[model samples]
Target: MDKYAIIKIGSTQYKIHEGDTLTVDNQNGKVDAEVLLFSDGKTTILGDPTVKDAHVKIKITGAVRGEKIVVGRFKSKSRYRKGRGYRDTLSELLIEKIELGGKKATEEKSIDEAPKKAVEAKPIKAEKKVSKKEPAKKVVKIKKPVKKGTK
Candidate 1:
């Protein structure tokens, strides 16, 4: 089973696996990614916000600049115009490995030594009942026409 993990860098989240290369905002140097979730194909573990004892090793490969973005402002009735352009620096990263509970995800148990424990089926929870409310109807009042001379 292929192992994978979800990690957060800055405010962005990315799903990554070992040996994967990803490009993101500049990090200046190597960063230890915060793992939000991890799955070993056979088992899945979720965190309240972030998984405990889970970490993703990342290495910064190189730095590159993003595409140029042009900004322009114009006003009518006046010959006022301004233009500007800029490029964002991006960093290329390589995913080294994912560690779950201090154990490397790449490590696998051989079939001969695999446990034969029975997998228990989890019970499904009941869905919540939502009450539907009707939208309010707008009321319009009709005004009677008054004579031109009448106050």
Candidate 2:
């Protein structure tokens, strides 16, 4: 099947296929930039902006200035005029691949490589020596000397 993808070149949307080199106003990076987006026929939405789960990729070609256009402002009666350069910055894209659903960001680990066993949390017990601790105070005992005469 002749699969065509809709991708955003820069500020504009473009319908392109493999090995197609396209230009846009400006892109995120220079030539051979890594980009990924979802593509079909109806729309080529910005995956990052709308759907974070979307998958798409692209490569940058080069950055160049477009044709300069003269912009003039003139008043018919007052005779006032001004001119300015209008060379727009643009970038090129070499459509690498369009992932319709999303990029295979990750893969499931094999059954043999199960998740690491969680650390067995033991109850924290302060191991203080009770026998070494001394009592707060010592008590003294006094006895009366009447035991000898009472018998």
By lDDT, who's the top model here? Answer: 1
- Model 2: residue 55 alpha-carbon error in angstroms: 3.5
Q: How big is the RMSD of model 1?
A: 15.3
Pairs with steric clashes in candidate 2? 31-60, 32-60, 33-60, 35-57, 35-58, 36-56, 36-57, 37-56, 37-57
lDDT (Cα, tens digit) per residue for candidate 2, span 1-151: 5546544433455666777888776765643222344445566555454445443355777888899999989999998998887898888767766555544323225568867898999999999877776768968789877756564
CA RMSD per model (angstroms): 15.3, 21.6
* Tens-digit per-residue lDDT, 51-101, candidate 1: 987877777899999999999999988999999999999999999888777
TM-score of candidate 2 versus the correct structure, residues matched by position: 0.47
Best by TM-score: 1
